[model samples]
Target: MTTYRDAGVDIDRANEFVEYIKEKVKGSFSQELVTEFGGFASGIEVKGYREPVIFSSTDGVGTKLKVAQELGVHDTVGIDLVAMNVNDVLTTGADPLFFLDYIAVGKIELETLKKVINGIIEGCKMGEVFLAGGETAEMPGFYPEGVYDLAGFCVGICEKGDVITGKEISPGDILVGIRSSGFHSNGFSLIRKVLKDSGVKLTDKIEEFGKSVGEVLLTPTRIYTREVKRLKSQVKVKGLAHITGGGIPENLIRVLPRDVRAVVEKERIPENPVFPWIQQLGGVEEREMFRTFNMGVGMIAVVSEADKERALEILGKDSFLCGYIEKGERSVKVI
Candidate 1:
C-alpha cells in the first residue's frame, strides 16, 4: 500500500517540526499575545490607545534570499523579513505590536528552520513586537532542495490623531536622513547579476569594505521602530518615509504633500562603502543608482524648522539634516 511519505510529504515529520518550533515561537511572546502557537489563529490584545488606528504591513525578502541560500546562512534573512514589514508600518508613527511569519521550504530541516526562527525572534525583540505566530510548509519538488522563502506580516497601533501622513508637510521643513546599515534587503536582483557577470564570489573581500561580499549582503535590515517612536514623542514630525525597494527618490516622494517637493542634498548623504562598490562593479549611473538603492539614507523624517534641532537631538548622530522641503509640484529632486 502507498503511504503519504512516499509522495514526498511526511505527516509525522511535519508534526515533529511544529513541536520543535513551539518554544522558539514562544520566546517572542509577551503580555499582548493571547493564544499559544498551535491555536487556530494567533490572538493579540490592543490596548493603551484612546482611539486606536490599526496599521498592518506584509512583505517578503526578495531576491536577497538567493545570497543567503548561496552562503548557507539562514538566520539573518528572517530579520530582513520582519524589518521589511515592521519598518513600513512604522512610517505611519505606529508602534508595532505583533508579527507573523511564513516559511516555505522544499524539505524540513530542523536546524536550519530553528536558525531562521531565532533570527525572527531577535528581530521581534529589536522592534519590540510580539512574535504572535507563524507557518512553516515543507513542500518538496515545488522548490529546489535546500531552498526556502520567507514572508512576514506586522501589525501596529497608533492614536488616530498621531498618524504622520505628510499632510502637514510644508515648504522649508527640514528633511532628516537616517543612515542605513548596508543594502537593507533591496536591489539584490541587479546586485546578483552584476556580481555574477563580474565573477565575484561571496567570499571575495574588497579592501575598502573590509568584509566579505556575503557578510555585507547578508547584513540584517535595520529596525527603525525605537528611534522613530522616540522622535515622534519628542518632536513634531510632519511626515515620515521608509526607504525600501524604490530607493530614496521613489520612497521619499510617497510621503510628500501635493504642493511641496523634497530637495535632497546628495553630498550630505553619509557615505556607505556598499553603494560605491556596487556602482564600480556594475558601471551603473548616478541617477539609476539613486533610483534603485537606498544610497545610504534609509529613513527620512520631515520636521518643521523649529523642531529640527530637537528631532536631530532625539535621532542622535546616526542621522543628519540631509535636505529641505521646497515649494513645488509634488515630487522629490536630488541636487
Candidate 2:
C-alpha cells in the first residue's frame, strides 16, 4: 500500500511550513480581520463605506523565480507576487484589504522558506494589507529540488461609485507614465531564452548595469499602491494601467476607452542599460523588446489634460507625462 508521503506528498513537512508562516501572517492582522491561520478559508468583516464593492486579483511571480532559485536567492519574489496581484486590484481603484499566498515546492528548506515569508511580510507592509492566510505544499516528485512556485491573491475594497474603470476615459486625456526600475516580473521566458542562447549566466555581471544578471532580473516588482491610492481621491484619473507581460501596447490599451488612442513617443520612455544590453546580445528585435519588457515605464495614469499637473504633483518624482490620448482606434502608438 502506498501512503501519501510515499507518493511524494509530505504532509508533515507541509504542516510544519504552515506553522512556520503562522506568526508572520498573524503579525499583519488588522481590526477588521476576523480569523487568522489554519482555516479552510480566511474570514474578514466587510464593513465601512456607503456602498462597497470588493475587488480581487490573483497572480504569480512567473518564470522570474527560476533566476532566484539558480542564484540561491529566495527573498523578494514574494514582493513580486504581492505587486502583481495588488497592482491589478488597484486598477479598479480599490484599497487592498488582505492577501493570501500559495507556495509549493519539491522540498522544504527552513531558512529559504523563512526568507520567503519575510519577503511576503514586507510586501504586505508595503501595500498596507493584512496577510490573511496561505498554504504551503511539499510535493517531492512534482517540482524539482530547490525549485518553488509562488502565487498570491489580494482583496481590496472601494466605495461602489468610486471604482475607476476606463469607461470614463475620453479622447485628449493625457497619459502619465510611472517609470519601472527594470523588467517588472514579465517575459522572463524570453529573457531566459536570450541569456541561454547567448551563453550568459546569472553570475556574470553586465557592465552596463554594474550588477549581476540575476540581480537585475530579480528586482522586486514595484508597488503602485502609494501613488494610485494617493491620487485617486484628489484627481480625475480616467484609467490606470499596470504594465506587465504584454508591455505598453497590449497592457496600456486594455484600459483605454474605445475611440481613444494613445500616442506615446518612444523617446519619452526612459531607456535603461539592461534592455539594450539584452537586445544587442540576443539580437532581439525592437518590436519584440517593447512587447516583452516594461522598457522603463511601469504603471500608467490616464487623466484629463486639465488635471495633468496635479496628477504629476500627486505622483511626485517617479511620474511624468509620457503621452496623450487622441481620437482613433483603441490602440497605442509608439512614435
Candidate 3:
C-alpha cells in the first residue's frame, strides 16, 4: 500500500517539524499575540491608538539566499527575512506588530531548519514584534534535499492621520540618510555572477572587508525600526524611504510628491568597503552600481530645512546630510 510519505510528502516528519518550530519560537510571543501555535491562522489585538490603520508588507531574501546556502549559514538570512518586511512597513511611520514566515523545501533537515527558526526568533525580538505563526512545506520532488526558499510577512499599526504619504515633501526639504549595516539584502544576482566568473571562492577573504567573502555576503540586512521610532518622535518627518532592491534612485523617489524631486549628493553618504571591492572586481559601471546596491545609505528621511540640524542631531553619528528636495516632477538625482 502507498502512503502520503510515498508520494514525496512525509506527513509524520512534517508534524514533527511544526512542534519543533513551536518550542523554538515561543520566545518571540508577546501578550498581544492572542493565538496559540498549530492554528490555521494567528491573531493580534489592536491597541494603543484612538485611530489605527494597518500596514502590511511581504518580502523574500532574493538571490542573497544563494550566498547563505553556499556558506552553510542559515541563521542570518532569517534575520534578513524579517528586516526586509518590517523596514518597509516602518517607512510608513507604522509600529511593526507581528510576523509570519513561509519555508519551502524538498526535504526537511531538523538541524538545518532549527538554525533558521532561531534566527527568525532573533529577528522578531530585535524588532520587538511577535512570531505569530508560519508554514514549512517539504515537497520531495519540488526542490533538492538541501535547498529551501524563505519569505516573510509583517503587519504594522499607525494612526490614520499619521501615515506619511510623501504628500508633504516640498522643495528645500533636507534628505537625511541613515547608514546601512552592509549591503542590506540586495543586488546579489549581479554579485553572484561577478563572483562566479571571477574565480573567487566564498571562503576567500577580501582584506579590506576583514572577513571571508561568504561572511561579508551573508551579512544580514539591518533593521531600522528602533532608529526610526526615535526619529519620528522627535522630528516632523515629511516622508520616509526604505532603500531595497532598487537602490537609492528607485526607492527614494517613491516618496516624492508629484511636484518635487530629490537631489542626492552621493559623496555625502559614507562608503562601505564591500561595494568598491566588488566594483573593481566586476568592472561594473558607475551608474549601474547606484542603480543596484544601497551604496551604504539604508534609509532616507525628508524633513524641513528648518529641522535639518535637529534631525541630524537626533540621528546622531550614523546619519548624514545627503541632499535636498527641489521643485520638479517626481525623480531622483544621485550626483
Candidate 4:
C-alpha cells in the first residue's frame, strides 16, 4: 500500500521529532504552566490577579533570517522568535507567562532543530515565559533543504486596570528610550537589499562598524523582559512602544494619546556605528534611515512628569530621556 510517507511526509519521523522537541520544551515550564508539552492544548492558571488581563503578541524574525541561513546559524533565530512576541506583550505591562512557537521546515535534521529549540528555551528563560507547547510542520517540497521558518505566540497577563495603554500620555511626559544592541530584527529587508546592491558581501568588513555586515545583521533580538518586568512593579508606565518594522514614530504613536505628540531629539539617540555606516554605504537619506531602522533606541517608556527623575534613577544607564510630549497632532518630531 502506498502510504503517507510516499508523499514526502514521514509520520514516524514527525512523531519522533515531537518527542525530541517535547523534552527540550519541558525545560521551560513553571508552576504557572498547567499543561505539559505534547498535549492537544496548553493551559495556564490565572489565580492571582484581581482581574487578569491576557495579553498576546505574534511575530516573526523578518528577513534577518536570511543572515542565519547564509551563515548556517540556526540557534539565535529561535530567540528572535520569542523576543518578537514576548517583547510586544511587555509593552502592555504584562508579565509573560508562556510562549508557543511555530516552526516549519523542509527536512528535519536532529542537530539543527535542537539548536533552534535550545535558543528558544534560552529566550523563554530570559523573558520569564514558560515554553508551553508549539507546532512543527515538516514539508519537504515547500521549503528548501536546511531552510526553515519560525514564528511564535506569547501570552502574558496583568491586572485589568494595570495595563499601560498610553491613555494617560500627556504633555511633558518624558520619553525614556532603552538602547538596542543593533538592528534587533527589524528592517532587514532594506539592509539586505542595500548590501546586495552595493556588492558588499556579508563577510566584508568596513572601518565604520568594525564588524562584518553579517555579524552586525545577525545580532540577536534583545529580550528586554527583565527590565520591563521589574519596571511594571515599581513604576507607572503610561506608555510603551517596541521599535519594530515601522520604526519610532509609527510604533510610538500607537501608545500616545490623541492630541499629544512626542518630540524626539535626534542627537540623543545612542551613537550606533552600524546605522551611519550603512547609511554612508547605501547613501540612504537621513529621514529614510530613521523611519526604517531603530536608530539605536529599541524600546521606549512614556512616564509621568513627576516620575521622570525616579524613572531615570531606576532605569539607570539603560534609559535615555529622549524627549517629551507636547500638545499637538499625534506626531513625532525628531528635532
Score each candidate by Cα lDDT. 0.89, 0.87, 0.89, 0.85
Please state every model's RMSD to the true fold in angstroms: 1.2, 1.6, 1.2, 1.6
* Candidate 3 segments whose C-alpha is farther than 4 A from its true place: none
Highest lDDT against the true fold, candidate:
3
For model 4, residues 180-251, the per-residue Cα lDDT tens digits are 888889888888888989999988876566877777788888889988876767888999999988788778
Q: Which 10-residue window in model 1 sums to the lowest lDDT?
A: 27-36
State the displacement of the C-alpha of residue 331, model 4, in Å, after optimal TM-score superposition.
Answer: 1.2
Output the TM-score of candidate 4.
Answer: 0.95
TM-score of 1: 0.97
Model 2 local distance difference test score: 0.87
lDDT of 2 by residue, 307-328 (tens): 9999999998888888999899
Candidate 2: which pairs clash?
none
Residues 172-255 of candidate 3 have per-residue lDDT tens digits of 899999999888899999999998999999999888767999998888888988888999998899999999888999999999
How do the residues 1-335 of candidate 1 rate in per-residue lDDT, one tens digit apiece?
A: 89878877777877877776676665546644665457667667666779999999999999999999889899999899999999999999889988889999888777888888888889988988888778888788998788999999999999999998999999989999888988999999999999999999999987777889999999999999889989998898889899998888999999998989999999998899889999999899999899999998889999999988888889999999999999999999999
TM-score of each: 0.97, 0.95, 0.97, 0.95
Name the lDDT value of residue 282 in candidate 4: 90
Question: Model 4, stretches more than 4 Å misplaced?
Answer: 206-210
